[model samples]
Target: MTNVAKARESAVAAETRVEKTVLKVLDRLHALNARLVALHGEIKAAQPVSSGSVCLELYPCGPGCAGCPHPRWVKYTWTVETPQKPSVLLSINLDAKERDPVLTLARSTPHYEKTAELIREAKSILLERKKILASIRSLRNSARL
Candidate 1:
């Protein structure tokens, strides 16, 4: 083959390889997007139960109290109900009657588990796409010579 024909063949081969690599990367990205969407849905559907008992201890005589001359302490016990078989208890301390505290519990429920799995799968796909991109870069560099 002439030098010009050889160059044209090499260029076409490189183009084909690059195209294949791009398609593979796109497929992986699509899968990752799907997994993220599913994970988001799972998180949105999760419901947590916030119910427990609260106790208040009042002291009638203290130097800091403006009117009653006493200090009071409040204690709250909270439990989180998960989709799993068991529930967990959360303990909180309240300083004053005017304070209403909000607490969040991060537990592994069924939805959480599914979300975690989807995240893992998405990460794996991302890693795969990264490797493919690296391979394409390597091919392009080699073709430049």
Candidate 2:
């Protein structure tokens, strides 16, 4: 074959390889986006009911220490009620607590709010991934490879 023909063949082969590689990347990106969506769903499922508001209160250190000089330790709790079972009480002591006089952050176990934020973040990522996949498909189609 002429040198010009051989160069054209090499260019075509290179273009096809590029297209295939891009298609694989697009597939993987699409798969990851799907996984992210599924993860977001799972996180949302762990969300607690909005009705069960958490309560925080201070309890006495002891009867002897009615006027305790030290700062009061707060208790955090929430109740879940269902017809099928007795009411359930859930509580957790926050880790890495700041010794500020007012520890309002520990007042609630609002996992739903945090999980909702995560769901939003994951959905945004999934949206961007889908956009990238669309752009890749557009490029592949435009290139006619």
Candidate 3:
């Protein structure tokens, strides 16, 4: 296969991975929302309770973080929501560790926030994949220039 084929394959794989991750993140958000909805019933009069932990942050590892020789870094963290307060980041690290329960979301961790973030990430990966695929197709369709 040519370099173009390799690029297409890699982009396709990356797109799949990003899509799957988005689903997982959305699921976590959904579960947290459900917990809060239930809590709201009993705590209708009590102060809102919330508790969730943050996993970690992502930082650029290379010069630009979006090209070859550079790696995009994601800081892993686990968060659990509390009674009324927002979820708190319990642990954080460079590597992703499934230490804490994810279903629990802190009330503070707004569902919109996580969903938006995941959507943005998924879109970005998909866009990159589209660009690569488009270029390959263009090359295949065009006559020798």
TM-score of each: 0.40, 0.43, 0.31
Query: Where does candidate 3 stray beyond 4 Å?
Result: 45-145
lDDT tens string, model 1, 53-92?
Answer: 2222224565642223122223334456568746556445
Order of the predicted models by lDDT, top scorer first: 2, 1, 3
| Candidate 2 C-alpha lDDT tens digits along 31-128 | 76556646544553544434332222233466643122121222244566678877655544322253321233323565645554554455465456
Poorest stretch of ten by lDDT in candidate 1: 65-74
- Superposition error at 105 for model 2 (Å): 14
Candidate 2: regions farther than 4 A off = 49-107, 112-117, 120-124, 137-145
For candidate 3, give the lDDT of residue 44: 24
Q: How accurate is candidate 1 locally (lDDT)?
A: 0.47
Most TM-score-accurate candidate: 2
CA lDDT of 128 in candidate 2? 66
Better candidate number, 1 or 3, judged by lDDT: 1
TM-score rank, highest first? 2, 1, 3
**C-alpha positional error of residue 82 in candidate 2 after TM-score superposition, expressed in Å:** 21
